[model samples]
Target: MGQGEPGDLTGRAFPLGDWGRPAERLDELYRWVERGALETAAWYLADRTGKRRGARVLRGGAAAGAVAGAALPLLDMTGVVGGVAPWGYLALLLGVACVAADRYFGVTSGWMRDVATAQAVQRRLQVLQFDWASESVREVLGPAEGTAGEAAERCLLVLRRFSEDVTELVRAETADWMVEFRTGSAPLGIQAGGVAGGRAAEGAVVPGRLGVPPGGTRPNMPRQRPPEAR
Candidate 1:
């Protein structure tokens, strides 16, 4: 881990400094991709889990509210609980409000999109690793039409390009998430034309809901073409 050293990545030592030594750089590049992909997966998994729970809570609250409202009128009409219908209606309103808030704030949609993105990224990493292994074998067994170093350089180019693509995609996702946090809107997967005219774009992030922001609240980045699968 010293400066200029790729360090003991796994069991192999990646040589640093030597453009003539693209094999080591290629290995290091793969390592970077693996590390970034794993980190990305973990972070989004946490996010997905948290938001999923929030979504369940919201759905339950809404259902409960609806039941209370419907049964209150019947209970009051039956005279078993006279004059309780108003309270029942109020409770229902509260429940509906909670659900509405959840939808508008994009709690459910955010989790789904992020989880999907995480899975996709993880799959890409797996493919990249597989390809790297295949290329390594090829380099070993294939005729030396090009020098080993030349082959390594080609591998570096491919790996670096793929790595950049992944990084940009993840970064774009984060930027969108930040905007959602600030603006309190979901990514259209949650609320698509059923209620509020498909515009659930208002709310503040509660503390401990996502992560604690600096000032404790904001609901909610940019558009980017999704990366192509390699």
Candidate 2:
């Protein structure tokens, strides 16, 4: 990867570009899509695995806290455990905190969402491979029955369409995630709604958040309609 190459953004499903000839560029475009999709799947799979473990830990912590909180006071009331009853309320509070943290951090839901998105992208990758194959077999060659330029044009068009689809797949997932974070229903990232309206609209990226200066993360491109599936 040279300076300003698209592959520089590791683990990102973003587009790629190269300074090669048209044939080389076309080959590279396909490779980039394949690589990006595979990496996206791998990243999400790893992410979901970690989050699944976190979800289990949170559930266990909450359950243990609740059991201790209840049994400690019971044992004290029965005179089986002498002065330990006073700590029961603290245990109950710990349980409540655990539950709150689970929701706030989206341990379970995030893992589920990651799995879904990863599988979706993987399926799309298969579809793209077959779609390109379908396009390659068509008799759309130039008047010479198989001109190099016309064949390359067709291949480029097919690759471009597939690339756009990949981008849309990622963008849709991102939009869903942003909406969840901002909406009050998730009990997660509620401040995002307020922050987006108040701070972000003023062209100021929150410090230590996103780490990208205003307009540097991605071009503020218009919403694109899904490309026709060919």
Candidate 3:
């Protein structure tokens, strides 16, 4: 990395007001992890509630258009809607529009990305908690390792590392999402009727595509920032 800006993940400050206070270190770590996890979870819910519905609706629309297009031609055999010629074209257009909308919005890809990010964050949170426990054990087993200040710094190091890891994960996810929005990522196809796009919209549910995931928020507690490493 060249000169890091304040906005750069590694350079950002996580001010820990009471980080050095012996009584508040545990609380501070808890606060830091919870806040990061909360934002990540909110994204998961937003996509579950919003974008997911839109994807489903678009897919349903494409299906409906396909049905109408198929039927209209048969109906034309029986002389319906003046002739199937115009009606068939309209149905075909509807399918294309729905498919195109699905691809352009990227709702399907978005939810998958959010879910993956949320799961990744959860795994890290688990690792942080376990690390805290491991460190506590080490402290008990060998408190004579160094001075009190050194011990506090050790705790600070743990907190700092956890905070940085979470920050980097979230920042990377958000950046990729923004870039995807600014410049589209057309899949293997964007041809007539957007057959590829329609497949993409429906692809989320296609079993092997998404893989396993993560969950469950911790209880409510007063928030605190992770200790800033000196």
Candidate 4:
């Protein structure tokens, strides 16, 4: 066997095969992953904001309607119905309108769908980032049963396929939303709610994960930077 430095592989910043093709291709892949992560983050923020606001509006409307309805009979019994009956009726109508807006007009549903899509994208990004950090390109792309050059080529091929898959997934998700927006069909919230109800009926409901995954670090991956560096 040829002699080489013992720490050569262990000391490198990345686990890619070499400094030539695999390194270059992996660098490009990392750039694309970083961009996708940024876009997903923005989408997630917008969806989360919309979801919270919509929920608040729905709850407020329900509370207002309840208070008004409860007071109507009391006002009538006290012989003061004439003064407040109209306002109570008006409040009830406003509450009904708000509920209809949330349910039928797709405000709440749209946000729900966006949030789900954003979360899916975020999960994919996390998987890719974790793989990049912990696994060598050869191991990720294949069984790592070949020479360095063959591994590099396999790595490139796998990255290409992964890139295409990610692109297609994102395109399909965005297109689905666009179609809903254009045609005014059921948004993701309503569909997911239906499925959830079905599952509950069948005793198959499962809770979702609520904890954050472990984080990773890489250059050019948007995170808090030191003030001097910024």
Q: What is the lDDT of candidate 3?
A: 0.54
**RMSD for each of the candidates:** 12.5, 11.6, 15.3, 18.3
In order of appearance, the predictions have TM-scores of 0.67, 0.58, 0.63, 0.57
Clashing pairs in 4: none
**Candidate 3 Cα misplacement greater than 4 A, ranges:** 1-20, 74-82, 144-147, 186-230
Q: How far is candidate 2 from the true structure (C-alpha RMSD, Å)?
A: 11.6
Q: What is the lDDT of candidate 2?
A: 0.56
TM-score of candidate 3 to 2 decimals: 0.63
Give the winner by TM-score: 1 or 3: 1
lDDT of candidate 2 over 60-177, digit per residue (tens): 8899889989999999999998887878878888988888887777777666655665665566667778877765555333244667677778777665554454444444434445
Evaluate all candidate structures by whole-model CA lDDT and list the values in order. Answer: 0.57, 0.56, 0.54, 0.49
Model 1 regions lying over 4 Å from their true place: 1-22, 178-183, 188-230
Query: Which residue runs does candidate 2 get wrong by more than 4 Å?
Result: 1-25, 136-154, 183-230
Best by lDDT: 1
Q: RMSD (Cα, Å) of candidate 1?
A: 12.5
Q: What is the C-alpha local distance difference test score of candidate 4?
A: 0.49
> lDDT (0-100) at residue 65 of candidate 4?
86
Per-residue accuracy of model 3 over 16-108 as CA lDDT, tens digit each? 676457637665655665565555545455444566787798889888888888888888778755577678769878988898887777766
Please give, for residues 1-230, the per-residue lDDT of candidate 4 as tens digits: 00132321221132334556666766766665456444544544554675668768886997798688668756966997567777777778888877776665556655655565455546655666665655474465655466767755755654444444344333333444444556555434212111111111111101111101111111244788678954
Model 1: residue 86 alpha-carbon error in angstroms: 1.6
Q: Model 1, 1-230: lDDT tens per residue?
A: 01122211212123356666666666766776577556556656766777888888998889899999899988999999899999899989989897888867777767765666566556656667777888888887994587776777677765655554444444444445555665667543221111211112122111112111011112333568999999
